[model samples]
Target: MLYPNSSSFTPTPFTLNGIPGLEALHAWLSLPFCSMYVIAMVGNCGLMYLICREEALHQPMYFFLSVLSSTDLVLCSCTVPRMLFLFWFNLREIDFSTCLIQMFFVHTFTVMESEVLMLMALDRYVAICYPLRYSTILTNPVIVKAGLVTFLRGAVLVIPFTFLTKRLPFCQSHVIPHTYCDHMSVAKISCGNIKINTIYGLTVAILIGGFDIFCISASYTAILRAVMSLSSAEAQYKAFSTCTAHISAIVVSYVPAFFTIFTHRFGGHTIPHHVHIIIANVYLLLPPTVNPIIYGVKTKQIREVVVRLLGGKRGY
Candidate 1:
């Protein structure tokens, strides 16, 4: 007759402390996100199809592009679908284990995307700066090695950080503020020691993200210097043209990522939650959506292939 039930109660589902205008804002935003996601998936899939079908584009550059499209596809799949679901259904409560998994893959693909961009930049540098040696230098084996290195680097670097995050205890409020489960946001809710996890997160930002950005910047600088030294205007123009798509993609990818990271680190509740949410969406979804469009529009060959594919379908 002693109260046994008092000691054995299950925890209630975690509810989100959504901001005042969050529902309205989320509703408004979901329309564009859904559109962007559809367009992004189509564009990326189309690029992959065109690249794989066209044997003429089976060189190192297009090979890298195919790989990039694949990565962007994965990156978009990781974050955008869940975000859309949360926006539409108001389903914010995530299982602890599932949240951790989402955080891990999101970080993994983000790092991999950065490495891919760096590789693309290096490929551009070689193609323009050393056209004679480009074929010899950027062989299949070399491209394979570059890809392997990128995969290994991203995989290895994120393990320690993710492991550190998993080890932390989350006995406190389990409600994560953000729409999707992110590392730092989830980490902040833990009741146990989080200093180590926070430090590890920062370490990852500096080591993996910062390092790749530095390398990409250096590669472009060298490419620009080499481009300037070339006497022929046509040659410089051609070389610069080759880089337009990549540069656009890089800016779209990096700027929002940096902004999101900076805001997460410094901005408090004083900053509008809507602003934070917008930045998060931009960081997660914009690159995938924009990259394919940039490449398709900037590269005439890709455009022609897409047009031909459409025309063939229409004729049939």
Candidate 2:
């Protein structure tokens, strides 16, 4: 029989430990976290500003990038401020409903980020491989439809996470050991059966992540083939150059994420909780901080526009 008090337990206001054993170091740690959040905010918001203000940037690639910037802004905003509050002010109490809301937005935006990245890859594929049809294929209407689909897909997939976490009775403890609420972390605290939670989480991860990865890989392969077919070295170089920033963004976003997922699920007693938390935090913060820089430095058009603005030139 389960513990006698399991069914009656109520986890109303969950306490977040904010890195558990490192409570004393929370102050020092918040410095870097704060810096990252600041950089992410400025970087993503600046990118959005540039994309919006410059008519030359009103292309499909930049449109996707603007969506990406917006997503990053939301994704990091969902957790970073709360994390800062907990670290700096020791405000650790988050009610159950708020926790679920955070989880929903975090996971939903993560899926949306993945879908957006995949769309970006598709955009590159068409731009490089089917240059002639690129304009006709990805029109304004199609781009808008794609954005809507990406949002709905992510929201629909992640909505179940709230339901799954809500129904479970968290009899073990109301204290979450990580910085922010996530599906697995929240579910793991429950004393009730969590098989359904685990199964659904894994299924969603595999179905969405697996499929997106496959599409990105396939798109890149075809892009490589098309680039290689180009007779001029300059043409091939230019085509490949356009993809470098996207590839870098993809690596930064996905690599640490998969590492954290595997380590959390399978590392067991071998992995330190703090290590898992740190990796999780890095994966969340790094992409937002890095993506804009990569695009700004690599994409000559954006770089030129930035120069023109700084140099006080008009008629951009």
Candidate 3:
């Protein structure tokens, strides 16, 4: 049960717990993060430009890639810039309301990205399993509906979770150990019993991440079975090739997610501070940086389009 009367709980003003000589460490970390942020932004922007400009790439798969790239760009922008600023100035304090807003956007985009992947898996399933009807099945109207559903799902699911987090009475230390205000990290500051918040978060994780992963796996399994029965070697090869990028993306996206969730729930504060920082950053930043590279390697047309759009002479 949630504790009522949280309005009376006075939160301590947040202050920076600056470690001595930490300026050097902050600089060391900021350099790499800034580089990664630049690469991720350029790569995703390039993907979006290619898809938008190239008429040949107007199909549903590339359409989904464009959406995913746009979402990644937003997600990266939401988290990384603030983190870089914090590290550069050693400003460790954030207003409570600002922290809540940041958490909302981070979780919202995270869910939206997961939904886009699920849509991508479904697109591949239709293309492979129902080749004759693929185009008709994935018409623009249908893709727009899928996008709407993804957006609404993220918005509706995250609203309640954010409210639940906000209602928690924070009467203890306000220093969030990690760079940003993660759900678990913020919940830790609440002086009241956090059973409700923890349970709600776990439930959302299972429903959002777990259910999406399960659906994607089921779609791909059906896809693999259909590919196996195809008599043509070329068809089988093509089918398998389409999935390689998505498979890599799924692995990269989920591993760090599960690691952070598991550590937050089970590891408690026993884990070292540095380890938590690493896992937190990986969960927030890795997908945006790696996803474009995965698509570039697996989808030749996208790579060609990206190259041409970047003013390089390349043909698919």
Candidate 4:
């Protein structure tokens, strides 16, 4: 394939390869992905609805959980529908503009979700470590401000890489070997220099992920120290219980993401391309699908409300 000159190249519609090596299994794959998507939608939406309706859940922690669910809704919706389309109907051709749009939301909301998880961790830290000041520190105004900051941080940081990717001339080929248009996949298919794109993507990812991890770590460390100092075993157990759901949330959110990152960067030919693609999809869907289940099972208030609603009971 002789390459066209970058200077005169015209952009073309990108073809998304959904599970490259498993094309024959695309229909079968759609079943699981579709099921996960439905679960994420129902779970996140139901969680948000429950939080809004139940007076007992009108706390700082539940407020953050609502935000987390909302973010998860957007994060999963941004990619899964189109992925399913490609799987079920084999609609792989995506326009340049649409691809860019998908790339933007996919990344922006991913950052937002990470920030929300970090916020949830911080909320737990305050509730356990500084119970008296929890309300004062996490007021409505403060929560709103934090939400604005996270939204802005994601938009501002992500715009540069998206723009950088856009400027690259795709003379090599427009076939993106993944289910969705991500920064690296799109950039790699371009004929132009992607050094800046690669660097900016890595730098932003590291800074954002590193800072969130640092804050979560610091918050948990302080929380552990405080819990250990409580002389009563019952008190210690009660304090630790509040964090179980949050700790689970963090693990599900980051573990698959890091695994996908490592496999992309280091797996080379040792890892199958389809495996990488599946992991990437799982990274997006797992948190949203599991979050409501985790909180519903772990949080007494949510569980009770769910039971009452299902059993047609009147009072709280």
- Give Cα-based local distance difference scores for all models: 0.79, 0.92, 0.82, 0.89
**Largest lDDT belongs to which candidate?**
2
Lowest-scoring 10 consecutive residues by lDDT in candidate 2?
A: 1-10
Q: Write the per-residue lDDT of candidate 3 for residues 1-316, one digit (tens) a residue.
A: 4655875564544543322235468878888788889989988997787788889989999999889988888888887887888778867777777777888888888899899999999998999999899998999999999999998999888887678877778765676767777787778877877788888888888898888998999999999999999999998998889889988888888888888887888886697667766677877788889888889978888877666656654442
What is the per-residue lDDT of model 1 for residues 213-304, given as tens digits with 9 covering 90 to 100? 88889989999999888899998888789899999989999898978876777775567866886788778888889888999999878888
Where does candidate 1 stray beyond 4 Å? 1-21, 311-316
lDDT of 2 by residue, 64-149 (tens): 99999999999999999999999999999999999999999999999999999999999999999998999999999999999999
lDDT of 4: 0.89
Candidate with maximal TM-score: 2
Better of 1 and 2 by lDDT: 2
Among all windows of 10 consecutive residues in model 1, the one with the lowest summed lDDT is 1-10
Can you give the TM-score per candidate against the true fold?
0.90, 0.96, 0.91, 0.95
RMSD, one per candidate, in order: 4.5, 2.0, 2.9, 2.3
Ranked by lDDT, top first: 2, 4, 3, 1
Runs of candidate 4 exceeding 4 Å displacement: 1-10, 313-316
Lowest lDDT 10-mer window, candidate 4? 1-10
TM-score of 1: 0.90
Q: Which tens-of-lDDT digit does each residue in 1-316 have in candidate 4?
A: 4545553563667899888889999999999989999999999999999999999999999999999999999999989999999988889999888988999998999999889989988999989988999889999999999888988989888888768877777875879999998878788888777788877877877888899999999999999999999999999999999899999999999999878766765685898888889999999999999999999998888999999898886553
Q: Higher TM-score: candidate 3 or 4?
A: 4
The list of candidate 2 runs beyond 4 A from truth reads 1-8, 313-316
